[model samples]
Target: MFKSILAAFDGSEGSEAALSKAAELAILCGAELTVLTMYRHHSVLEGSMYVTNADQPDDVDAIMSNHAKATAERGAALARQAGCEKIRAFVKGGPTARTIVGFAKEHDNDLIVMGSRGLGSIEGYLLGSVSHKVTSLAQCPVLLV
Candidate 1:
């Protein structure tokens, strides 16, 4: 039985499915659950690009960071509604696959449950899905939904 379960959620349909499954498993096993949302770490150049937008706020990075936090909170709420009592949510900015795997290891998670596909860009298809990379890189068991 899983003791610590981590779910990678990106607010996509696939991620929703994965989150649901993770919640169910956590409730069944009486395990701790964590919902993780990964956002892009904007570079100086990328941050500068947002400065020209008339409607965008002064601190674009802060806005994006807050959005990531909100997404993670939503995922956690969904898990709680699904009957998972022990659940936490986190948001980080980095390479998605690497971040997920690293968090799982750092948190000593027993299992990783994530979507087969997330709200990835076209580059994901060109390179690989985050789930694919996490599965290859994680030391613990990975379950893709």
Candidate 2:
């Protein structure tokens, strides 16, 4: 039985499935569920390359981080609605697969549940999916939903 479960959520359809599965497993195993939402840091170089709205917030990175935190909170709420009693939500900024695996290892999560594909960019096709990288990198068991 898993004592701590980690779920990588990004508010996508696949992630929604993973969240539901994680909640079910958490309830069954009586484990504490941790929902993680990771977003890439918006670099100043990227922002400079793209035109910004005059009324847009100047702190773009903070805005993106806040959005990720909100997404994690929503995922945690869904888990609670799905009957998971012990739940926590976290948000981070980094590469998705590395962030998920690193958080799982640092937190000593027994199992990782995540989507097969997330809201990835074109690099996913050139490189690989986040789930694939996570399965290869993670020390614990990983379930892709």
Candidate 3:
């Protein structure tokens, strides 16, 4: 039984499913549920290509961080709707898999639940999925939903 559970969410369909499962398990185990969403810090060149708002040209990282925070809150809302009482949501900017694993370790989570796939780019297909990397890196148990 888990005392604390970490759920990796990206606002993708796959992640939604994983969040639901994580919520169910947290409720069953009377564990605390922590929802995490990660965003990558974009370089100036990369940000310029993706920036749409001329007003906030150099705030790409802030924009992405805000979006990630909203995504994490949305996941936490869904978990609460599923009857989970003890829940917290967080957003971080870093390499997704490594960040998740580090957060889980830092928080001493007993288990990590995440989707097999997420809102990853073509790089994920070429390198590997976040879930795959997290499973390999995490010290605790990882459950891919």
User: Candidate 2: which pairs clash?
Assistant: none
Candidate 2 least-lDDT 10 residues: 119-128
What is the full ranking by lDDT, best candidate first? 3, 2, 1
- Count: clashes, candidate 2: 0
Estimate the TM-score of every prediction.
Answer: 0.91, 0.91, 0.93
lDDT of each: 0.90, 0.90, 0.92
Task: Give me the displacement of residue 52 in model 1, in angstroms.
Answer: 8.0
Better lDDT candidate (2, 3): 3
Q: Where is model 3 more than 4 Å wrong at Cα?
A: 54-57, 122-128
**After best superposition, candidate 2 residue 108: deviation in angstroms?**
0.5
Superior by lDDT: candidate 1 or candidate 2: 2
Model 2: per-residue Cα lDDT over 2-119, one tens digit each: 9999999999888999999999999999999999999888678776666556776666777778789889999999999999999999999998889899999999999999988778
Q: Residues 37-105, candidate 1, lDDT per residue (tens digit)?
A: 988877777887774456656666677888899999999999989989999999988888999999999
Q: What is candidate 3's lDDT per residue for 11-106, written digit by digit as tens?
A: 998899999999999999999999999999999888878836766546789989988988989999999999999999999999888999999999
